[model samples]
Target: MKINLRKSLICINQQKLIAIFLVFMFLGFTLAKPEFASSYSINNILCTMALYGIASLGMTLVILTGGTDLSAGSVMALSGVIGAGLLGKAFSAANPVSLPFAATVLIALIFSGLIGYLNGIVITKLKIAPFVATLAMMSIARGLVYVVADSVVQGVSGSPITFMNDGYSLLGQGKIGAVPVQFIVYVILFLIVFVFLKYTRTGRSIYTVGGNIDTAKLAGIKTNKIIVLTYTVSSILVGISGLILVGRLSSASTVAAKGYELDFITAVALGGTSVAGGRGSVIGTLLGTAFLAVLNNGLDIVNVKSFYQYLIKGLILVFAVCADLFMNKRVKKS
Candidate 1:
């Protein structure tokens, strides 16, 4: 009965639970460290939300389709490096020839999306597992970043490319009045993706495919195409995040975005997205993103050590996954 009741609550009030938890966390943090409630702190958390939220939205889509992209962080790094090489000063501080900002962004996105497309092909055509395929892609993409950066810099094999262009910086650092430009961009992207998932035939197909590919095929849905498109869309969103991160840091390195996949996956899982696929919402992901942003900020404000933070986050992920499994089992039994 306790399990049934817990499952009932989760099924009916998953988003509400997330919202309540976020509120409690905020309140608790504010009480613990009054500085956490400061305007600057609030703005910082919001910016972090925008950054992680955008990528988490993409992860939500892929997770909903019963697949995961471990390559997201590496893909972002590759895209950021490519963008730095193009729109910012050349990879070398010496040559320093910058291209049009729009063109550079366009090229980076295309390249990242292509990587995702290839990942999809390997999974669909070669019948490889999503985990193995994306893991291989992650290593390949990271290595490519080193190769590309070294080629551009001519001596900087492992050094970061510093590109502090005003236009690039504006994307991550600029404000519209008091609101971060990145946050505004994140909102726009979120709305667009939400609408697509809610209203489009292809979007519906994604859910069907994830739920049961054989059933989806029987229904005449192009399961392979849907899977591929989900991955491609995910990588494009990762590119957006990479571009913003590069703008924020004013540089790109092969090491950038390392371990970001953990954060993304954690946010998606906490948002109530089933790792088994076929159930999730973009809005839930936003809330989940906000929850982590606040948690991290709170920890920082309270001077929590980095090691403890990692431990806490890891434990939370385990708990979230266990909860998901329990809920899924209940659903199946019912």
Candidate 2:
């Protein structure tokens, strides 16, 4: 009875452990730099959290299915360039296309979803590993960024597409009272995903697919469809993030969101999600993203060099993966 109780306690306390660590880290940062607690800095952290957190949520979904998306950053860039290029503005002098904001956003999301669908089809139909398949898509999407930029902006093949649109900008920069609109959107998305994963039939099937593909298949679940659906949803969320980024910057560069995939994966891993799949939560991911946002902002506040920041984040990722492996072993033993 004691051992059984201990096992249940372990399961319950994992998320709390992360939350406690986050609080301690926040306190430590505040002590090291007094200004770290300032409202401006806090708001900055929340904004960063929202920007990356939205994509990380999608990443959480992908990882939960024992898959990874190397193309997310590229997809984000693609979406941004595509959306910005299509806007009815004089941003890109070479591009003659102009569309309403809603149309532009819809078109961008559709393309993103298509890319994700192809990824899933390749993984399922071609029997390619997710890593290899997504790696290929990453290259393809990035190359398309350059291609799209060249086609739209003509002579300035690689230049950023700068635009001025107040309505679009509001998505990233507007605030409701003291809170940012983007952050609010992030929260809404988080709650929606949480409810979906916890309450929906398809959501539960994702877990079963990730936990044991063969068993899921035997249980009469269409594993392929579930995988495809998760990937599609992941890309669409990433597309939304891309649009928000463009709004915030008022520009979309060919290199926008470059290498951001690492940050998303790191956030999901640090949040206690299993790389092996089948055990994790969006709540854990939210906490993990908060921890990362604080760490980055705090590091900048203390004037830490970018190189060292990279090293520190890399170490944390390694540690998180190791810890996850250890926990999985313990759970199996119990």
lDDT of each: 0.87, 0.87
Can you write out model 2's per-residue Cα lDDT over 1-334, one digit (the tens) per residue?
9988877767634466567767887898899998999999999999999999999999999999999999999999999988888884745466668898889999999999888999899988898999999999999999998887777775756988788887568887888899989999999999999999999999999889889999999999999999999999999899989998998998889999989998898888788888788878889899889988998999899888999998987886676556656775777887
Model 2, 107: alpha-carbon shift in Å?
Answer: 1.2
Ten-residue stretch with the least lDDT total in model 2: 9-18
Model 1 C-alpha lDDT per residue in residues 105-129, reported as the tens digit of each score: 9999999999999989999999899
Off by over 4 Å in 1: 1-12, 88-91, 94-97, 320-334
lDDT for predicted candidate 2 compared with the true structure? 0.87
For candidate 1, what is the lDDT? 0.87
